[model samples]
Target: MNYLWPILILISLLFSIFRGTIQDINNSIFTSISDVVTLSLTLVGNMCLWCGLMKIVQETSIIKFLNKLLNPILKWLYPDSKENKEAMKAISINTISNFLGIGNAATPAGLKAMEELEKENMNKSELSNSMIMLIVLNTTSIQLIPTTVIAIRASLGSPNPSQIIIPIWISTIVGTLTGILITKILLRRRKI
Candidate 1:
């Protein structure tokens, strides 16, 4: 991966030089850097707001209530880790965070859930089924709000930043179901 990036950059440099667009590339680099800085600041502010709200949510009884509601579904999805309270709680928090579309905030909980699941893993080298399911769930996260995306759109001056909400809902639901179904089918085949 390290070599791949350098090679791609070199290729782009050579192409730009041959096309007499080296100046254009230089200008683009500066423009991109400026854009990145602006975007980063916007994202940082948005993240801080959501992360603070998440912290407050954790402090309140809302998390416990949500955890109770999610327990049955989580247990069905992660049967092996059903009895592990820590793992279950971490999973619930991670899922809730993802649903709120704050992936950066969800990361810590996801890592904790992975660690707890790892404790029960018989094979240290390979991931357990529950771990794989967790990965799928995180990747195909069924976002209910997708605040991060909306924030980006708003920062970019979109007329209606929330316009993509419906599409996001449909796509995330389809993606999550497809990912779960495929993971289950593949795991079943592997066992046989």
Candidate 2:
């Protein structure tokens, strides 16, 4: 990521300069920076709201309930993962945040999940099975609420932002299944 960003920025700058659009490039840079700041501020509220809800659910028995509901599938995905309680809980929160469509809220949980998984890995050089599976799951997050997208659309003054729910659900379900299938096949191949 560190290498990719500078290379990308350099390329973009070169392309803009070569195109003789330095004025446009300067305007675009400032506009993009402004947009990013505005967007981050807007997203902060949604993230805080969902993270608060997650905390509430955790305090209640609801987190346990959700974990229980998700346990079977999670076990199937990574049988040894739930054996580590911390990793299991982190993964559950990560999944729940993803389901609620609060990707921003999910970041901390995902990072925690990765940290827990790394601990379980014992500083191994190679990625563990659970790590691979987690990567796959994150790539194709199973979105239930898509609240972030909806909120963004609403903030942009869309007439009916909720209209995208059905389409996104359908598309994401297919994508998640496909990604899992591919990941499983590749992992199996690696083992063999």
- Report residue 36 deviation for candidate 2 (angstroms): 4.9
Which candidate leads the pack in TM-score? Answer: 2
Cα-based TM-score, every candidate: 0.68, 0.73
Q: Residue-wise lDDT of candidate 2 within 2-45, one digit each (tens)?
A: 89999998998899889987898789889999999999897888
Please give the lDDT score for candidate 1. 0.86
Q: Which portions of model 1 show Cα errors greater than 4 Å?
A: 1-63, 155-157
The TM-score of candidate 1 is 0.68
Error of 2 at 105 (Å): 3.1
Among these predicted structures, which one has the highest lDDT? 1
Candidate 1 lDDT over 72-156, as tens digits, reads 8898788778988778877888898888776877877788789999999999988999999999999889988878789999999
